[model samples]
Target: MTLYGLKTCDTCRKALKSLDKVEFRDIRSDGIPPDVLKSAYAALGDELVNRRSTTWRGLSHDARAADPLTLLAEHPTLMKRPLITDGTRFFLGWGKDVQADLMR
Candidate 1:
């Protein structure tokens, strides 16, 4: 299992604490692989971007309108927290459905 998120994010911390035997990758330092970002975009679409985040708020209008992959590649923090993947499936956020899936 692999988890992609900011090391400073509280939600990511919580997920790291809850999920067992998972590898944690901080996107800020390590950066997201293009292939993974592409797959995430395919699966989650615009939902993958955390538009409400300060990073997004700071973005220029043009940047905001850019493609999701471009946004994420430029500003990784724009991505929602704790993008968990089991090398097959992708799950975003720590919401009920995601929690249930992780708990399985």
Candidate 2:
């Protein structure tokens, strides 16, 4: 399993603590591969982007109007926290439903 998120994110920290044997990738430093971002967007659609985040709020109108992939590529923090993937599957955020799914 691999977890993609910011290292300083409290949610990501919580997820790392709760989950076992998962590789953590800090999106800010390590950066997300285009293929991985593409796959995430494919699986999660618009939900992958956290429009409610400060990162989103800080974006210029033109930047906000840009494609989701471009937004994420320019600012990875725009992605919702704790994007957990287990090869074939992808999950966005650490919400209750996602937590339940992870438990399984």
Candidate 3:
């Protein structure tokens, strides 16, 4: 399994600590793989973009209006935190539902 998120993200840290033998890819440094990003978008849809992030707030209205996939590709930090994939399915965020799915 692989966890794609920022190294500075606390939520990512928590998830990383909780998951054993999982690879942590800091999006800022390693950059998300194209295939993985596409798979994540397919599963999470528009919800993949983090509308609540500081990066989102800074984007112009036109930028926000652009295609979600384009926005995500241009600004990776705009992606929601801790997009965990077990190579088969995707789990976005570290919410209870996601925890229940991944913790096992």
- Summed backbone clashes in each candidate are 0, 0, 0
lDDT of 3 by residue, 1-104 (tens): 99999999999999999998999988888878888888889888988999998999999998899998888888999999999999999999999999998887
Best by TM-score: 1
Best model number under lDDT: 2
> Candidates' lDDT values, in order?
0.92, 0.93, 0.91
TM-score of 1: 0.97
TM-score to true structure, per model: 0.97, 0.96, 0.95
The stretch of ten residues in a row with the least summed lDDT in candidate 2 is 87-96
Task: Provide the lDDT at 87 for model 2.
Answer: 89
Choose 1 or 2, whichever is better by TM-score.
1
Q: Look at candidate 2 and give me any clashing residue pairs.
A: none
Better model by lDDT: candidate 1 vs candidate 3 = 1
**Model 2, runs deviating above 4 Å:** none
Off by over 4 Å in 3: none
lDDT of 1 by residue, 1-104 (tens): 99999889999999999999999999999989999999988988889999899998999998789888988999999999899999888999998899998898
Could you give me the TM-score of model 2 versus the true structure?
0.96
